[model samples]
Target: MKKFLLYFLCLISLTSCSLFPRDNTKSVKEHTGKKAEEHQITPPDDKEPNHSLLENTMELAQEGKVATSNFAVHMNSINDVKKQWGPAANTDQIGGIYYANYPAKHTVFGYNAKNILVDIRSYDEQLHQLTYPQIVKTLGKPDYLRTNQDDQIYGYKITQQFELRFIVPKNTEKVDHISLLSPNDTVATTTPPYILPIKGVSKNLSVTAWQNMQNWRNQMIQVAKNHQNFVFLNGPNKKRVALTFDDGPDLMNTPSIIETLANYHLKGNFFFIGEKVKKYPEVVQKAYTNGNLVLSHSYFHHDLSKLQAVEIKTDLAQTEEEIFEVIGKKPALLRPPYGAVNNTVITTAAQNGYKIVLWSIDTLDWSQMESSNIEYNVLKNIRNGDIILMHSDDDKVQTAKALPHIIEELTRKGFEIVDLQTLLGQKAYK
Candidate 1:
């Protein structure tokens, strides 16, 4: 469990400098599900961190400030930081800027000649499972997307004098570390192409059924890559399940479904068709403001597989525009109408910055099955990381009826109901 950081400081006064590592450069154990949760923005601990602290760390990070609990007040001098986080595991200097690296705390402090803290770069694994989409949800899009060594940087100009940068290692959407720093301490960085989110199995899968689901998802990911770009069949392997409603924002069923979710204090993913969203803008806005996620299901209920690439793009763009006008942020997740997607549909969707999301459990609520049958479909076939698909269109009377019982039963079974962002660990909106 020990890691030796090689602190080799390049003396180049030209390019932007990073704590290029040596000695132990093997990537952090590719954590999945529960293990990924263990490494958070804070130092590693046996006990799970308070939810408030996680929020505070991320909230403070936006303003280029470390949390007060994590020695933000001690940045006055190197001596002050040493008193709190303890001495640095090692020290290095580059271009007269003194640096202290804390291996245990997964932090580094940079000081100018005056010996005052100027930058904080944390290589904590807490952010290891977070993808670019998840960060986009929090910080909006990065102001600058740059490539730095083996990592890509998503830089935000937090203020005129400071920048908050993300260090995403190559080939993975996970963040290796982050820096809350001054502009003077770092040089300008260049932008790169968009990075895609990764799909992984959960670490909590002990049952054979869960293991089989994990294997199926892995094979599907590979098969998807071979033909289309990518498609997310379900969420991360976890104890979480997402209840997604499609073809919604109608006057009746959508509202009833939303009401049912609210009564249970739960949030579900709603993929609204563009025409319906425009027809029921109020419904769309209400769903969004009520803490539910609204995504795209294309402009019309057309079979996208038969459409040309350009035509698909047009549909997706129009649908997103409608969603953005209603919710104020463009969606990054898409569910093709009728789940009809060929390579063209997938390729065009990727070009427009969307990941195709399909359901693992189909409740057949559209079939007008009785509430009990719909409940049976979900409760009987539910597995870890399932995205349960249901309809919220105006005519689905049975669906609205089945929702409440399903929510109550899922809670009783101890299945954590989560939003699409939490379920996929990706951006819900861009």
Candidate 2:
């Protein structure tokens, strides 16, 4: 059950969660993909976890008595759980998820950065629990059955938004614990909060490699706030970052990047040049069908900032046409070549229903840098909400080689690799 967050939510929500298999016409603006900082879940008032609320809401149930299962499973948010359970007895966090355990109550609650309850669990040995035979007799076969070395998990659809599971020991039939979880809930790390460290990659390193680009990144963010058509530069500071490639759909590097991304089950944003799409239609189509966003770079990778308004619009149209022919849809995003833009280019893009996509991390992979420096540029400067920039042109073989390492390192550090649509919660197509 523990896997990619995007696919998990999508499949569980019937493709309604806008992560993968997203609705083309619907904007996923509601879900803010902000990740939580690495820290223990603590009481907001800086007080210890107490049972005051456990006593206060002891009668909130319709049955005129406390129903711990109902309170633990049905609470709307972490705040609701906190109001009922006081605070967690112990807390741990990994990859934007918080695990707050209440041992005496035999309950644990999981929440995302938004404080939305992702799951709840209870494991009280005192309570007479159901065996596998009893569960099958009472519930009439589980909706899903999963067998592991130590246990067999039986899951039932508890409601539209959540599932109820019972874990039974593999050798013994007796139920071990119960959980109420949504598809959005990622499995907590085996050691609770331990994220494996990559050998050469550390997020805490201070790398002043591209100090000018960093400064310019700040300036672009400020400018983007003033421009309605500029959708986003980077996402909120959190555990997720987007990887985007540019100037691609080449025979070698583009397909190589796409295959490598598929190997890791990650989706990338490909701002491909239109003219190249005609030359490599299959490569472009493969990226789209493989779940990558094939957005617009330009018709011929010209700098729109220097071009006239009509020229920019023409390039947009030509780019849209080429992509539409290859992928059968029009992209709504435009990453102006060289990240160069002016008032006219912004206005033209707005008039054309295209949002300009920019980056926060510039990898400079187009410079034919060695694979080590390429990895260094990304991992050394990686942060929450970063929009990474790299190239997939045929000449940039080093980029294709550096990609898998970057992805592996990122995941080992527990950063979710998401697409622009998921990170920005914006529409990818017109």
Candidate 3:
């Protein structure tokens, strides 16, 4: 009787275990489904991210991974960078350092000798896109701040390694311009010094030389102020003669003249016609880049003396505007068309902050004269502070041919051939 009772109890226990196994399995499956529902990544309500936002996010992700703290200083080569981040959007070289600029990412990578990456700078477009409060929220409080009254620029140093600068216009909360910089990188602060846009002039000149140049320029300006209608024909007692070419910046003869002047280590002035300047701005830019003086020869090359005051003003003003457009500054000197300035031309030019310039010696190159005659006309009549006039146009082929001989002869005679600005110790542009 005891054995039969024990077998009945064991059968009951086995039946209960089998019935509970299915319940346990169902419970485990329900828990897994709940977990999957909680963890699933759902698309945003808007569906797709804006293209710009998506691109920025991707760029940020890549930058965060590759530019881990101080990684830029450790990067070996530009090739390595290309391998890691792909090709840069734009590349430039300045002062022996290479820069890879990524506009989309708002980042710049600087590389030194052997293409070793030296610095990485990232700019936040949010400075312009977002409000000031938003920028503060995103970047946090800066470690340092600076304000410039002259330019109305506000600067914030977020860290010793990072800086933000903005151009804050007057009476506006909007930040119009933004830039990021790496304070630790010497290349970041070392910009090419603002040498006046005269090409070929060495900014590496001695301190005393620079001082003397400044003093002379100041004196000339004072003199101009005293005499309103006078044209400055020569400079101080420096054993130099200014070689000025007029009616040009034409493609045909201007380049050859520039090359010849460069070969002799001399400089010349090209008084450009405003109409021609519009057509050949690159030539004018080339002359300026080569350290040559580029001044106005009037807009239409029409004689200012013959025109009415308004007409003269219009012509001169148009020429000045065009020159400023190309070079970012207006010429301080003006040569009247055919050197025919009357009282009206003088008053108009003076009103516009231009000092009238006329030649001391005419080469007759505009007359299509022979190269020998051009050379003799210069050499025979050359003197200290003499301004010799030549031409650089299609008809002035003889002028280009005679330039080398003119420079060599002047140099041999102990005369320094200089541009009008240097000869007069005056700033070429304002």
Candidate 4:
């Protein structure tokens, strides 16, 4: 009986141990079923998984897996943006790109690798008013902003007290571009207050230089009224004063002369070197538009009297081409380089359809004389029909200093300053 009880107990223990498996593989279906239930309960829309997706996306972008942020979208008008949030704005052009208002407060337009308008942004402050010529003079470019069948848009911005963006457009046939906007939010419709063409003289100039010339003309008319004809003059009496200038349309100095002349109400003949005009086309255009005659000094200030015939021809042609390219008016007047024209030089100029113009009185303004002395000599030498010569190069600093006195003295005297065109009764090429 004892043996049977012990055996029975051992068997019970063995069966109990077998029924409960020692390894995790006790019921494979039950383990899988539990895992599946846990997955279902976790939910697809949980925050932890969503966060992981965002982090992965950011990391992909940082790795340059994408060319650009898919967040990019076009903005037609800036008015749509909230002023405070200030979303990043940029413009992309071929070969170039720039961010808006990164370092400064002025409205800025930057060029891309292709030198096209890549970026534009608002700026703070009012900048000095810039003319089209001034713009070209400073920038040496014209950005093709937009174009349609009727007109082409050119973007111009000024950096000053307040940033101003100007959208200038040119008609297909006209040489001038009308201002489409101003800093004052003034919409330029037919014409802006003071605008010039992108690359040439206009039918009329309303720039500061032109206004100055007009003022000078009015003053001259009030006095002698006889100072008619453009840059040079030869009346029946042949008693004329040719107001001739050499070397300029300087960006700073020329404008002052223009303003002084306007104050006196006069115009004069400008003998420009090709290099200088190329440097400051806008100033030259201002001269041309104001009815101031533009004449050639030389292609590179080489005296035609000394150069060979081929050299002279090449020089003349190059200068003429530059002038025509900027003013759309080829010069018909030639002032031999350094006033050194001989008969051969004259003949060459004549062959090229240019009239050889010589000065009657040299002011020697090009010399480093005292400004007052220069002023006195010019004033003292004035005659009823004298051709007075001066220079426009900044190196001719005396001329700039003496200008106001000269104009004031001339105004006091009876002689009127007139351009060669009105004086010569011949059409000007520029």
On TM-score, the leading prediction is: 2
User: How much is 117 displaced in model 4, in angstroms?
Assistant: 60
lDDT of each: 0.68, 0.66, 0.59, 0.48
Tens-digit lDDT track of model 4 for 1-430: 5554322212211011121112121111233543211322222232222333223323432332211212111211221221332322222111112122222333333322222322233222221122333333333334323332223223333321122122222332211212212122111111211111111122234588556545543433322211111112222234446667888868777777766676767787789999888889999888877777888888788768788767888899999988998878788787776656454564465446666665545565654356766665566655555667778777766677788787667767755666766665555673
Candidate 3 per-residue lDDT, tens place, 151-261, comes to: 223345444554444444445544444434333443432343211111112234577965764564455444333332235656555688898989987888998998888
Question: What's the distance in Å from true for residue 419, model 1?
Answer: 0.8
Could you give candidate 1's per-residue lDDT for residues 311-366 as a string of tens digits?
99899999999999988999989999877766677667765667788777767665
Task: List TM-score per model, in order.
Answer: 0.50, 0.51, 0.47, 0.44
For candidate 2, the lDDT comes to 0.66
Candidates by lDDT, descending order: 1, 2, 3, 4
Ranking of models by TM-score = 2, 1, 3, 4
In the range 1-430, model 2's lDDT, one tens digit per residue, is 3345433332221111111122112112212332212111232343322244322222232221123445533346666765666545445443444556676776666666556667666565632244655544434455655443345555666556567666566566666666566653443322222111111222333466345445555566555644422446777667999999999878999999999999999999999998999889999999999999999999888878899999998999999999999888999889998888776887687667677888767777655367887888789878788888889987899989999999999999999999998887667998
Q: Tell me, what's the RMSD of every candidate?
A: 18.5, 20.0, 25.9, 32.0
Can you give the lDDT of residue 176 in candidate 1? 70
Which is the better candidate, 2 or 4, if ranked by TM-score?
Answer: 2
lDDT winner between 1 and 2, please give it: 1
Note the residue pairs that clash in candidate 1.
39-126, 40-126, 133-427, 145-191, 146-190, 202-237
Instruction: Superpose all Cα atoms of candidate 3 onto the true structure and report the RMSD in Å to 1 decimal.
Output: 25.9
Residue 389 CA displacement from its true place in model 1, Å: 0.4
